[model samples]
Target: MTKTHEGYFFEDYRVGQVVRHAVPRTVGAGERALYHALYPARHALYSSDSFAQACGLSAAPLDDLIAFHTVFGKTVPDISLNARANLGYAEGRWLAPVWPGDTLTASSEVIGLKQNSNAQTGVVWVRTTGRNQRDEAVLSYVRWVMVRKRNPEAAAPEPVVPELSDAVDPRDLVVPAGLDFGSYDFDLAGEPHRLGDYAVGETIDHVDGVTVEEAEHMMATRLWQNTAKVHFDATQREDGRRLIYGGHVISMARALSFNGLANAQMIVGLNGGAHASPCFAGDTIRAWSEVLDRAETGAPGVGAIRLRLVATKERGGGLRGADGKYLPHVLLDLDYWALMPI
Candidate 1:
């Protein structure tokens, strides 16, 4: 028997199947250093231990996306190795802070699947949870991907589409234990705007753009341990262009939003997100955010703000066109809830 292990294809998944991903990672200050180097991330809660302590966390935890990318990388071989595209995300929540020296592992359950009419591709939906060494869940989310089939003639499985919510419920959000914003420092946080300063229906333009560098994208993907061929091998696509990983775009946009949303410290919920268009090297990424909603939380001196964060290659393009599809310039549209000082 051959020792080489090939990745799974469309027909390899079934509803209710559980996959325990391999290679748990221990995250620490090094990941934070690399993250700041990779993106212009300067959120004070993640930058200083004292600021986090003043906010009631024992220490500054890792950036939320660090935990996301690490866990996501673990599921790639099992869920998206042969994928044509990672379609969308929904119902994501950070259950607890991933402190320094915490080891994380991931597992996924196949919840839904449907074959495409083209017969060469199918969509697989899975709910993945990332846990610490103590087996306490730190993050959870649902994502669907389009995977290619090994044989076009193979029979299709019964379609089972999961009923997902449009957004995460505000009442269901989990605030990290001991997290209190009562003593938050606006001067140190870099923004004076509190949760009350932002109004529903208000939009803020984050007036900065970063052009994508081929080397940086590759390094970022490799840092996540993602080995998807399309991200590194040009021969995988007919256009001879490498598709920048969507997570890269998300991080870039989130970092850019720091100018206007510096106090939106912790991302507690990811209601939904879509990769509106594929990004390639040399694209200049710009971002904007619109306040969607607000809610009160039991956490002392903390409130929740729902936001629609949009990333685009160019400025001034409306999110949708007359046909009700995303404009060509749009790269990513994400909806999430964050904690801010009240």
Candidate 2:
């Protein structure tokens, strides 16, 4: 009898399978402290209790990416333990604020599956939901990964690709209750830009960069409890180097955006995101954002803005080339809607 556990492979998933991930985490101030220490995150709503209260929150909530990384960590053992790459994300939404002392768990349902033509790997799409202890869903998103097959000769499963939206509908964005930014303090927020100050088709070069370090990247991944081997095990890849988690790049880019978008406080919806290239320890990440659209919400002093946030190793390289593929320097391309003071 054997009592060891390996992980799922390409041939092991079905279109309707559901996986309830284990090891629920209780997040609080400690997570917030470590996150700030790891990255140059200075978002006001996530930094000070008083600042959050002034904006109508009970207190400062954890950084939205902290919630995302914590929840994403729990799903690693089940969904991506043997993944070759985490491809993309879609239809993500932050439904509620995750406060200190909140316990979070995650579950995922396999919504789409397609075996690659090479037969050695396949794409598995899952809709994952992270819920707080009270059974209230705090976050939800669809992510797909490429998984290696345990048996290369296994027959391919029937392909069932999901129909995903190109972008989140602004009307579907959820604004936190009592999040009134009408009396927002421009000085405190560090940027004078407001909801009305930004126009559609405008672009902002954040004009900053941070070089990722091996120690910091590893520490950040471990802080989130992400146990994927490629991020930590140098032997897993051909070059004998650790791969930085894609989420790390995303958070780094978001933190850099604070220079020009300090008031884009809460990320309410994640329409789409693609990790265009692999980031190593020494890559210096820079960010830029283009205002896609804006809308008024029913909540007083709250509005939504859709923006495309791009992370690149070098500046001034267009996101896409003439061939319609991502440029070599582009590391990440994310589209989302965030709440700002009107």
Candidate 3:
């Protein structure tokens, strides 16, 4: 019988140690369709095979976050199995666009570690890289997590924390080569908003909702290779409900913003994001976006827009708000940056 790898202890990791995660996935039209249905993504290149071919891609590729999830999911056994909290991510970049039928694999190198003062926990940092079948780098990021030590009395390991970039510079943003929205169909893309129309500090209420389902989430998690037990196995959860992946909600909200924020492009900064409330199979997910800031990137024909995406559930036959905050129906609060046509 093949033994299942539960996870590793804090004592097991060492600087320079490399951990390769298993299971590569091939994205397909179903995932693409689900992405559009879940969020409202209208990027012409990703929405239509014909349009993608015009942009030089053989077919519509998977969304960027899909690639991130596929890569990040691989590290769960090596990184977050016993984690108390995900500290942060830095220097994250998407190098190459991933297409359907492309296989994605990932590995992470232990970069640094710090034994916490409490002794029961320590912080571990790793630089994770995702590569496609051809061995080209797809995405990379540095992330740290607070991991609980099995034994508080264990001897402390050498403390090391590598310095990471605060944000990927705007000039460093890579636009998909040959991408041209000049002949893009605004109506078919689901929005008429253009890069020149949006003003700074504008808030757009994306008027769409999707009630997530257990089967849908399981399919998504498995598709990403995110084998987090709680997200799939009902027996592992106390309430007998499958916990949805946080990133799923994030992508859903980001896609929903497409209605009025279609030009919002590459996600440059993930300042702060949260799954504010637990979402279940029957809870309908609705999203709204607030334009937080805007700036010009050095990249030709591209600009950066910062946005806050809020998702909520329907209650009492209508969406409800509690005081100044989103009601318990609120599912997510995400702050991030995106590159857009200018």
Q: Give the worst 10-residue stretch by lDDT in candidate 3.
A: 315-324
Summarize candidate 3's per-residue lDDT along 194-277 as a digit string, tens digits: 566777667678788778888777777776667666687778667898778777777777777777777664565555555557
Write candidate 1's Cα lDDT for 1-342 as tens digits: 998757889999999999999889999999999999999999999999999999888899999999999999999989998999999999999998998899999999999999999999999999999999999999999999999999999999999999999999999999989989998899999989999999999999999999999999999999898888899999999999999999999999999999999999999999999999999999999999999999989999999999999999987857999999999999999999999989
What overall lDDT goes with each candidate model? 0.95, 0.94, 0.73
Strongest candidate by lDDT:
1
Task: Provide the lowest-lDDT 10-residue window in model 2.
Answer: 1-10
**How well does candidate 2 match the true structure, expressed as C-alpha RMSD?**
0.8
TM-score of 3: 0.81
Give the alpha carbon lDDT tens digit for every residue of 1-342 in model 2. 878658899999999999999999999999999999988999999999999999889999999999999999999988999999999999999999999999999999999999998999999999999999999999999999999999999999999999999988888888888888878898999988888999999999999999999999999999989999999999999999999999999999999999999999989999999999999998999999999999998888899999999999987858999999999999999999999888
Q: What total of clashing residue pairs does each candidate reach?
A: 0, 0, 2
Q: Estimate each model's TM-score.
A: 0.99, 0.99, 0.81
Ranking by lDDT: 1, 2, 3
- TM-score, candidate number 2: 0.99
Off by over 4 Å in 1: none
Tell me how many residue pairs clash in candidate 2: 0
